[model samples]
Target chain A: MNLTQGTADPRPANPVRVVIVDDHAIFRSGLKADLGPSIHVVGEAATVEQAVAVIAEQRPDVVLLDVHLPGGLGGGGREVIAGSAALLGSTRFLALSVSDAAEDVVAVIRAGARGYVTKTISGAEITDAVFRVAGGDAVFSPRLAGFVLDAFGTAPADIADDELDKLSARELEVMRLIARGYSYKEVAKELFISIKTVETHVSAVLRKLQLSSRHELTKWAAERRLL
Target chain B: MATIPVRPPLARSSDRVIAGVCSGLAVHLGWPVKNVRVGMALATLAGGAGLVFYAWLWIMVPTADEAARRNARRPASPIAPAVSQPSGPGAFAPGIASPAVQAQGAAAADMTAAPLPGPPSAAGASPLRGASGSSTADAGQPEATPWFRFRSMKYGKEILLGCGLLLVAGIMIAQMLGVDVPLGTLIPAAAVLGGASIAWMQLDETRRAGLVDKTKADQAGGWARLAAGLALVVAGVLVMVSGSGSWEQTWLALLSSVAVLGGVVLVLLPWALKFWRDLESERAGRIREMERAEIAAHLHDSVLQTLALIQRRAGNEHDVVRLARAQERELRGWLFQDPGREAGQLSDRIKAAAAEVEDLLGNAVEVVSVGDAAMTEAHEAMVQASREAMFNASRHGGGTVSVYLEASEAQAEIFIKDRGPGFELSDVPEDRLGVRESIIGRMKRHGGTAAILNTGTGTEVRLRLQSAGTDAAEGKP
Candidate 1:
């Protein structure tokens, strides 16, 4: 629990606090070292049980989560989030894994993780993702965002079946790109719209589907085999 | 009176009828021959027991000529030396040197000396002699039998034709004498002659046994023989039935003919069926052998080649481990699972392969596929070759290797770009077969093209495979 250094980012009065949950000690320490002082590492846990306990006690602004872990009813990162359901309002979850499998991405996202990025990405990209998730924005790698968009995008028949006809075609398009594992910037670029407009369509799509988050939308689309 | 010398029993050859057992006994026991004959005839008239008894004694007693023949044929017994020594008065009796006397004494001595390994007594000797004699007779009988001899004779066919002519001549002579020949007799005689001819021409036991050794090529011939035999037997029965004077007699003739034919068929059917079954099994065995050869060739082409490649790179521990892991995944999938014929698109497979390679080598591979190409026949080969090229790039290149897949209806092309300091193609040693064989050769065999280029920035391997309706083009810069 080291949180002394926070000098690099002076924009926020309090720096984004992150609890690193990973099964590997070297990876946790490496990620912590790479995050620098701008993102304070308040606590670290190597398993789901420890992750839940630490996240509950620390109530960090964002939890940098690994999708697979040992212990805590075998749910891995999902178990930690489910176990700490109460603190989810205050604390966000950002998934970091070496797997780029679409199933892994959709599974963690469905469990209420704000973003999913592979371990191959640079440390700076991960730091940016954590801050963005801390600020209440969904972050995803370009390909991972495609996975989310594909998983959540409604098929033509499903729109009528799930009563998703309330969403406009533009909003559905935005949702498709976003839920298929594309980042907001990529979705905006793909649709030839601004990032703000992409955000507006995502919120509308979520609202029309009566979903609270993009993660749930992705789970809904995946259940319908849209991806 | 010249004293009749006492000797072993002998049948008198001159007074013999049916081997002269009564005369032999009469001589041996000092009875009158007429009394012996009258007594035998009375006993035979009483029951059949006397006839059997006569037959037994006939076989037991040797004739005077046969006794002389036995004396001539006898191997000089070891006991001859003892008799020659004349240790007893009996041995020194007069005429003892004569062969008949010596043979009689030896036979008596052999009967007494049970431990001696001399020839068995005449009564015991019959069965052993019968067994050996029958075996030789069986071996020689085929050659000596009239049918076989007739068939084998140089002029046998002409002699048979002459016999037919003689029969016809006899019928004509009967006609000239105003003696009517019945059609029924003539038809039956023709049937019997025809059956005999067919059996002689076709039903050779040696040839049939040879057919059993041959393949199914002789199946038609076997059926023809069966049909011919059945027809002949039926014709004979029909002719016999029609020729009979009364309905009861015709039925009796028909029943007897059917019973005889049925017995013949019952004996031969099993052999015919077994021969047919053997031929069928031989054909099935040949087909199975061909299938096995095909499977063996497929294993040699794929799995064995991978195993050989794994062995060749044994010195590179990392490469070996990585290749082993990849091969294990592939082989397990091949052996345990269906070959994913209904799998996802080509892009998905390419991504999956890249991910697998990345996992094995701890490297980063960024797969960016632009189009969705449903997997076709050539897609599998293209994916495999592209995976190999990607693996090569990842192993030798610097920075994250980027795979760009452009799949169109006409063709699908994949380019693997890496930022490493690329070496000239000539710099690769002859022993480095991974690129030449697994990548280039694999693509070539699939009617695809693979090009390795050293650009200013890094190395790029391009693979292109044509789909349906497109002519396969060679590598282009």
Candidate 2:
């Protein structure tokens, strides 16, 4: 929002488009009233299901998401929360949860929410989160900040690009198939290549890498971060 | 001292017809898994790369770490190697006979000579012998196929992705041949193919067979992940291949980056997790077996000592028979677990209390309990409560304590009652240690109640817990 307010901003004369995704109608109305005239409220969704629908429909820049309701995940709707997280596109999810349980709190955060705030948060803080989320910044409360940091604190594994480079595109594909434990014939069938082709690839990979066997390929792949 | 550490120039895995020995050599010698894979691809494209290292690594590196870590993980032998006093045996040397185990001599020496860090239990790799690699489904006159599909719930998705890729390839080929095919038809076909592929993975041979270790399987899963990634990469490459019509062609580069990164993440991340998990589980199992072995040895020695003492003390043959009977019961429980395997996995407190009570009596006895269900916090509390009740009943209540618990729908009700002269319900003193501390203490923690209900009909103590089923469902994901 501050970026937009600075007259030197390069964006065309468009408002910061927003979508309200709270289960509570009253709060949505209150949020709209609170933001006043500058921010444009493009859509409203009452549950996670509806939120998804509105997101796909409006392509909203930002969404104020409620963490739980009657069924928790959404309505008893079929388009439910899933493991892939593919369906959640450009629209960022900013959670409003009443729970402080670390597991519940952490789960939603991990599920691609750009911001997570307890229901106890004031409207002012929520507005701040909305602005930050719209600008592509991650937002969380102080306690939650620690949780996020801990969750992502893993040291970046130094993958041996060299080990990865050893595989030809086709051989890499076959190796990946093999590492997935694909049998020679199955891999041959899958690649639309011959069973002999699969065998040849496997043998070559084994000899070239000095892996000893298929299992070492697996171990080496993991250690050098290739698997 | 001034020499460089020379790595092998080529990977052993890249060359072999069955395995990529050459690429493996290349990688070991500071090369790439890709280079090995590609080299193998070309070698397969030609003939096989000379598989010089295939026979070498197979012969050279240890076959399975299974044997290497077995002694380290298992409990030491019962008969102390240092004190070679055999229990009238011929081949029962001071040490066990294992050709692979010169290290056993050192381990045995360390065990007898050094103070044990904790228990007689061995440390790691106890369960390696158990996680045999072959699947049971491949038993009998199995057609030794060279292919083994990684066990995955989302194989259908992978297949679908493959189909999608093929469909796209087909469409592109058709377009090149100047034959028109609608993308609308192709896209849906791809989607269907992806789903079918994932389902195929689920029913694949490796998953259905018992021979494959089910504890670990392929980590990659979920819908359209590979498809999405491949699509992105393809789109990016296409954009770059087409010359920049506009400076906005940078969008193609951005899209390419996302696609490549996403595909790599989806494809590779799961493999990494599975590898780590396999290593962890292997180490854990080896340690567990060693522990069990040590326990078995300890129990054997303890039983022998007790039986000898009982034989010496018994006044008559009849007395000897009775003492022998009791000793037999105790020894059996120690060596082999009861039906449920509970007595074996019991916590120390329960074991200690059982021993203490049996010690108090003229006859030494051990009560063993095993769990058929997951052990949770509430279950542990209940187990502790049972120990307390058993102790109180034998010592003060003057009767055998009978315990029965029924659990359903997350609620557990435990009945701990003794058959002694039932104390008056009202006279149950608030400060009386057993009734006050043991009975009420555990119940209150689990948001439940303990009461001395229906007294004189044997002091019937009923504990009603609403959430004690937590411990019963422990160890489940």
Candidate 3:
């Protein structure tokens, strides 16, 4: 696997810059309170309206955006849903909702969220989402990940159709994660492969199957349960 | 427009005016009851309309209050016993006859109480006109007060009106469409249809439920009545306009105009309201009946089945009674929108239940709650089943009681898990109600089913809800 510790951007140096935008005040505060001095909560908002404003002003690296809201500012009213789509440079929105409703799961992701997770998600998982969204990586709750895969009707490189018949376990894992829409670099890192090596394996995969693009590849892999 | 007298003291029905609550408040309070209602209505308008009071009265007061009152004015004690039971004409006690017959016999009995809402002092007064749409708070108030007893048919009011209105509207529309028939030509049909519909609602419930089925016959009767009335009026018109045209032509022209006017007035009026409301009553009554049936079916499948299983397995234990107690609470909840007998809020109820069931069965039980459970069918089932499941898991499975409740318009599900020994299909105990009655029976009744699945380390019970039917059949295969 390719691993790199790129030097931290000096401009926002040291502590991770986080902004919590969950509608649940207790959850948002509890997260901030639990993360302790390790992470900085630059700003917080309880609803989409306030979240947008907070993101615009604070410009934190990560925004813990709750997918539900309470009492005004368009909690789940389908308004201002598009409000959080465009974030200032380097800032990312993470979805925090109660259920992994497909519409909602797809909405936040389509709205340019870094990740989509449910409130049932664990504290560790939530902390992971913040970092992943901030770092331009997609974070999804396990069920929510299924919803996203369902939403686009596509899976990542390693997974797709033909599972009922046969596929090696390793091949299955690779196909499933790839059908999940992971980037080549991400997939290679996850699967512990060198970039060139990943390219070679991908070429062998394409040639052995005669598939054209990654889209068809993911669809085929999903059909076989290879991923 | 006819003035309707809605049960008085329209504002703040905190305390019913004993005869004068309305008038006394209107007097000592210095405002007419009607005026107070109007102001309260205006406030409802000023704010967002659904302040709660208006919606409260709409369903509380029956539509035909005036007619009910007229019935109430009859001499008392004669029909009291029968009316008290709300049955139709011939209901017999116990071994005597069917409930339907008894109910039918008792049908006319309610007349005394039914008519009492009408003011005792307003006996001979002209019928009052009720306003059409109340402010938000007053949303469901009936727009018209019905007659004490419709000497005219009350049930047919709507169809007659609708047909008349449609005809009048059709006539107006035809006129609009450039038809030669003038507006006056449509009026008679409108009035006849309208008048007849209002006339029908004056009939009894058997007639209302469409159980009587003589409505079409009544329409014929109405037609005969209208024809006779038209004949005389036409004859009079002919004598007056004699020599203008042949007798046949004069008669035709006269009758046609009268028919049109009659249809318009009768159908387009409060008279038609009785018919319209009867239609609604029939529909609402059907819905209530369906809901009752649904509750009964679930109670049978879930609770009754569980009881049967308990009777088989362990005979009857303390836990069985506790489970039965929980089931009773659920049944009461189904019957009442708010069973004031509830000890605590829903969350507290579930929480305490989780703790109690765990202790009872000697297992760990936990509850995770989201969304409100008030009145939602899913919430009721989830809470009830979870209570039962907790007992089952603790008593049988030897695992912590875990229950999950979820609800949405399109779907609802209750999932439960308990950790202990896994259920063996081979060791099926004779008296195993936990599996039979609590889980399997309940979901089946709701058009859903329950299945036990292996959850790696423990056993999980999943109840999948069946969505609406009829609409499903429309889907192409």
The stretch of ten residues in a row with the least summed lDDT in candidate 3 chain B is B124-133
Which model scores highest in lDDT?
1
Best-performing candidate as measured by TM-score: 1
TM-score of 1: 0.37
Model 1 spans > 4 angstroms off: A1-14, A98-104, A149-192, A197-227, B1-363, B368-374, B377-398, B402-477
Off by over 4 Å in 3: A1-13, A47-49, A70-88, A99-101, A149-227, B1-477
Evaluate residue A211 in candidate 1 and report its C-alpha lDDT on the 0 to 100 scale: 46
Poorest lDDT segment (10 consecutive residues) of candidate 1 chain A:
A1-10
TM-score of each model, paired residue for residue: 0.37, 0.26, 0.33
> What is candidate 2's lDDT per residue for B370-414, written digit by digit as tens?
111223566577666766666665565564444433332245444
Judge the docking of candidate 2 as incorrect, acceptable, medium or high.
Answer: incorrect
lDDT of 3 by residue, A85-132 (tens): 455346666667653233343444444455556564556556655554
Q: Tell me the DockQ of each model, to 2 decimals.
A: 0.01, 0.01, 0.01
lDDT of each: 0.59, 0.45, 0.45
Looking at every candidate separately, what fraction of the true A–B Cα contacts under 8 Å does it contain?
0.00, 0.00, 0.00
Q: Write the per-residue lDDT of candidate 3 for residues B105-153, one digit (tens) a residue.
A: 2232232234334222112111110011012122111212223232124
